[model samples]
Target: MLYSMSFPLSHNDKNKYRYSHHNGDSTCKGIDVHEIFMTKSRVRLLLSHIGILVCLVNCYISLVKDKLCSSSIWKITVIILFAKFMQYKPVKKESLVILPEFGLQLETHYWSGKIARRFVPGGKILRPVLNECVTPFTCYWSLALILHGEDQLMLVFQELKPPLKLLVPIWKALRSSFDVKEGSSA
Candidate 1:
């Protein structure tokens, strides 16, 4: 069976966020796929295009009006800053594919149609952890893997940090797959 759900990232966010789970079938035995997608906002995409167009027009006018004047240099610098600010995120979605009898596959999909994937064998995965990451200005929840013989935790969703509400179900599913006992962090 395939289960899918979607909601806003936040009250003020205009972007659509969704996740889906696909249960394994006979073709791919014992495989479970969990995916989270972030759709780009049309308004934001339009604004970014307009901003880039305006920046290019201004840059050409400034360069033509004064070849090497200080004013032209300043104008170019401002245009570059604006272009950087208007840049859109490259990642489109991320997925976790669990093969209970084999291992886990982490997949990242980019807006440029590129997919980056990594695999970890079932034996190498010590545990699935839910971490509270604290930054100077804010805090967020993250899902990670405690791998055998590895010092650093492997983050499941590298580019997109979905909320705890989204991470809990995945965490539970992972724990169940690994047969992890509750109240034990061994």
Candidate 2:
């Protein structure tokens, strides 16, 4: 993107005083004027260029070994261009705290990793009626656990609920019913 600084001056004293500020364009609108004008050492720019060249060389060598040099080259080129474009672009930060908690803490004491709770016996007795409500929530929890960086073993154990384990056939039947309903609606 081109950098152009606009100066707002009165017609009477256009040449007498000069002011420099951002020339807000479609691409550079969000960038701070100070950051764009800040000077960097020549060595930094040279090192960045060398780093990109090294990555490209590695990609090319890997592509040649795979016998997909042409397609891989195109993909790598696009990826590099995209990275450059994003580096130049200013973006707003996203918040991790905004993720939906989905009533995880409120539902059952066992879910919160509380060991003292007698949830297992209750779960075994409540398996039949609770399967419908539990399956969707169980699936949702397993997915959320994965998203929250839990280990694979924890994810497996968390999903091994009495209802979820016993009601696999019932869940499949429900899924088929939904597909039939969707077909009819369409």
Candidate 3:
């Protein structure tokens, strides 16, 4: 059986994000898996590229029309670089594959078709925790793992930060898979 849930994007967001849970099957050799996909809109991508092009064109026009000095040229270059940096998102998806008797697999899928995975054995999983992170501008929640030997907690989702509502189910599933009781360490 498969279970899925999608959260509507806020007014300011252009991309759609959702996460799904897939039950494991012995016959197919599939393990219980939960995946969060970051879907990019083609129109949005096109528009962003167009905006960057327009910025470059305007910069060129300014140089020709105003005979800008080196300082102004440097300013234009900085703006273009900042714009490119802000628009770059390489992660396509992130997943948590549950291996019942073994451990959990954390997978990160990149836009360039690269898959990076990390495995944490069941014995090493001290517990699953939900953390509320506060920033000066915004607040967010994150799911993390407390490994037996690791001093620092490992974040479940590295690139794509899913909201608290989407993270709860995964946190519970992880707890259950590791046979951990509420408010108790493994």
Query: Which candidate wins on lDDT?
Result: 1
Each prediction's RMSD to truth: 3.0, 25.3, 3.4
Tens-place lDDT per residue, model 3, 1-186, is 788866665644324677888987667354789998888667766777777777788788878876898877886888688668647476889999988788889999998999999998888988999999899989888999999988999999989888776788899888888788866745
What candidate 3 gets wrong by more than 4 Å, as runs, is: 6-15, 28-30, 54-77
lDDT of 2: 0.31
Compared with the true structure, all predictions reach lDDT values of 0.88, 0.31, 0.83
What is the C-alpha lDDT profile of model 2 across 1-186, one tens digit per residue? 433433443453343222122333685443222111112335645666676676677677767776776777677777677546433211111101110111111111122244321111211111111222246334421211211232332121232222232223323332242232433421
The 10-residue segment of model 2 with minimum total lDDT is 90-99
Q: Mind sharing the TM-score for model 2? A: 0.22
| Best-first order by TM-score | 1, 3, 2
Output candidate 1 Cα RMSD.
3.0
Please, what is the TM-score per model? 0.79, 0.22, 0.78
**Ten consecutive residues with minimal summed lDDT in candidate 3?**
7-16
Residue 26 Cα positional deviation in candidate 2, in Å, after optimal superposition? 33
